[model samples]
Target: VVDRLNLQAIVPSAQTLQEQSSRMHLKKLKTVVTYWATRQIITYNVPPLAFIIAANTNVNTGALINLYSDLQKVAIEDLFNKS
Candidate 1:
């Protein structure tokens, strides 16, 4: 991991990294994008959360984390049966 970090730092800049990322082979692109989207919480885990999200705007991040936790608290019955 340390070696990877060192090599990553050697990349010239953000622009260079963006260019290099295209060339880099990914074993699991979904895993990479999942992390980029914060374990998919900020993307699709909770539908309400996904609907209202806005970028480049200031808001309390803690509330989002708590909200995600609250939504994740599903009962077993909620999981097993549906209409």
Candidate 2:
């Protein structure tokens, strides 16, 4: 569906709503509030354009993106071990 709509980037900003750890509550508050603010500003002030860039993700997602590789010895061995 996204490809059909020609949407290049789908910021999962709201994905932060899933944060459930007490340790991450503060960070979640910041992320949700920031996303809301940006959404409001863009919705009322500036309209979407062809080349506009946006981002959306929490710590886990951010770290996943930054990870260079997921290849692992255990993963490879498991793949070959008919389970």
Candidate 3:
């Protein structure tokens, strides 16, 4: 299922992390485009180094909202429930 596929993707990245001496950590970057209630699209970019951590860690929604708020006005409900 989805979990297995996600794990398969993580293994290689985990090895890379170890080999890199743990100096680097994972981060997930997301980009969103919204058009005044006409359309909304969200895109996620997972760096190869991040796949391992992503498989295990839950993203912090509050932090993401704070990060993206500078780009535009972000509503908590819109982000969490996608309404």
Top-scoring candidate (lDDT): 1
Which residue segments of model 3 deviate by more than 4 Å? 2-6, 24-58, 61-83
lDDT of 1 by residue, 1-83 (tens): 64555533332443443444455553223111111212222222343222123222244445544554455444223545552
Lowest lDDT block of 10, candidate 3: 47-56
- lDDT string for model 2 (1-83, tens) is 64675332333333442342233454422222224322311111111211123334333544432321232334445556956
Off by over 4 Å in 2: 1-56, 60-62, 66-68, 71-74
Per-candidate TM equals 0.29, 0.19, 0.21
What lDDT score goes with residue 29 in model 3?
Answer: 34
In angstroms, the error of model 3 at 69 is: 30
Candidate 3 residue lDDT tens string, 1-83: 66556544334433443443333332223432211122222222322111112322244534443444443333444455764
Displacement of the residue 56 alpha carbon in candidate 2, Å:
7.8
Which has the greatest TM-score? 1
Q: Where's the lowest-lDDT run of ten residues in candidate 1? A: 30-39
